[model samples]
Target: MNNPSLISGTTFNEIFAIMEASFPVSEIRTFSGQRALLDNPNYQLFTEKDTEGKTLAFLAAWEFPELRFIEHLAVNPDIRGGGIGNKLMSSYIHRSDKPLLLEVEPPDGELEQRRIGFYERLGFQLNPYSYVQPPLRAGQADLPLRIMTYPQAVTLKEFQRFRDILYTEVYRITVPSSR
Candidate 1:
């Protein structure tokens, strides 16, 4: 399958709608905040569109010197489970050489566990170390989430490094002393 195209201005609103639908309010950045990320050289929004040009799925990624972080991957809810997601992620992994990292909700429920299993089937290993995703919006407390890495599991030091970079760059916040 061909790789998805980089999202353009014309597709921004449609892509954001997919994101808002895929993630909970506390987990997603504000609309303006998301727009700001598009200007960052490290960030990318890849979208798959139908022949008629309607978006089918998207993968939002951040490229750091040491790692490739998948911030979000959402398929159109109407057409999910039809292998679009697998193709999108496989295309990304085929193009990327850096270690790929992503956050997953802890195995708190069946749906969450299935989400983890989805990545696991794609060859990502779940890390056991504790992780807290700093709030994406104001007035929300830190959220506990797990780190999953493609190719292999991460060491404690590696996890800490990933956490530091995400906290500083993506969330724009200082790592709490308690962590």
Candidate 2:
């Protein structure tokens, strides 16, 4: 996993490919927008590559002083289920003791439930808050998602503070407070 250094050239292209194949358009940014994120000091892209140096999985995250927000994490669709995601996440978890947080779709269906379960297995608590994720780009509506935190569950105040930080930093946009 490359840290502090930015991913560029073919590696960047390959990572973007996996990102597009793994995530929905509404949940992701455009190629240009995604590429531009590397310029942000707080953002980091961690990839787990195979022996041939091909990107097999990647975790995109923002590291704030008190919070580590995992924006996106996806394994190579073709080679998933081999425990790479778990290793990657576990490694990231051990990298720091700062409180970790991430967003996931509400468990309304089987796949979503499975995802939440996976995180739960890793000691993440799915917080039941009225969370509406700000759009990653223009022309997209706010997405209703749930927050998952490691180590412990968050109180309403903590959730609100995290939300504000995410909006102000990750999304780079602000909205009226969600009561």
Candidate 3:
């Protein structure tokens, strides 16, 4: 397989089709909601390409001066067990100079455990605090979100500030009813 390429809305609709095919509807909805906010100038899309130059994986993030909040990361389910996801993440970590932050579903099952473990292998540490992510739709249940911090030593206060900004800016636009 080949490495993925990083792209923006210039090719996002096509990329989203791959995401929709691989992930659950709820996950897709959440991703679409989040992507809408990051579509502005301050955000970036990092995509991985295969040997044939086809998109294999993608990671999207919002770039602030001091931090990069990974909003969505996905690898096609057909190629899940391969190193495609790892490569995509490693590429971002290598290219980014700022601390990275992201959220993950709580480790509730084998799948979630594996997902968390994958991030851990990439040097992400789970913050002890918990949060309720705003819902993807009105009257929908809020998600139980866990924070993962890259660069290990990032303070809890820093993470909390990031979370606060995310809820206020991203969540408000994506899921206004939850506010």
> How many pairs collide in each candidate, listed in order?
0, 0, 10
Candidate 3: regions farther than 4 A off: 1-10, 30-38, 173-179
Ranking 1 against 2 by lDDT, winner: 2
Tens-digit per-residue lDDT, 27-116, candidate 1 = 789999888788798888888889988888888888899999999999988899999899989989877778999999999999999999
Worst 10 residues of 2 by lDDT: 1-10
Question: What ranking of all candidate models by TM-score puts the best one first?
Answer: 2, 1, 3
Candidate 2: where is the Cα deviation over 4 Å?
175-179
On residues 1-179, what C-alpha lDDT tens digit does candidate 2 reach at each position? 77636586788898899999998998999999998899899999999999998989999999999899999999989999999999889989889999999999999999999999999999999999989888887988999999999989999999989988898999887647663
What's the lDDT for all of these models? Answer: 0.87, 0.90, 0.72
Q: After superposition on all CA atoms, how large is the RMSD of candidate 2? A: 1.4
TM-scores for all candidates? 0.93, 0.96, 0.79
User: In candidate 3, what are the lDDT values of residues 1-179, reduced to their tens digit?
Assistant: 22223355545665686778765555545556645654476667777777665777777677777677887788876788788789888878887778888888888899888988999999998887877777656567777778888978456678767777777655654434433
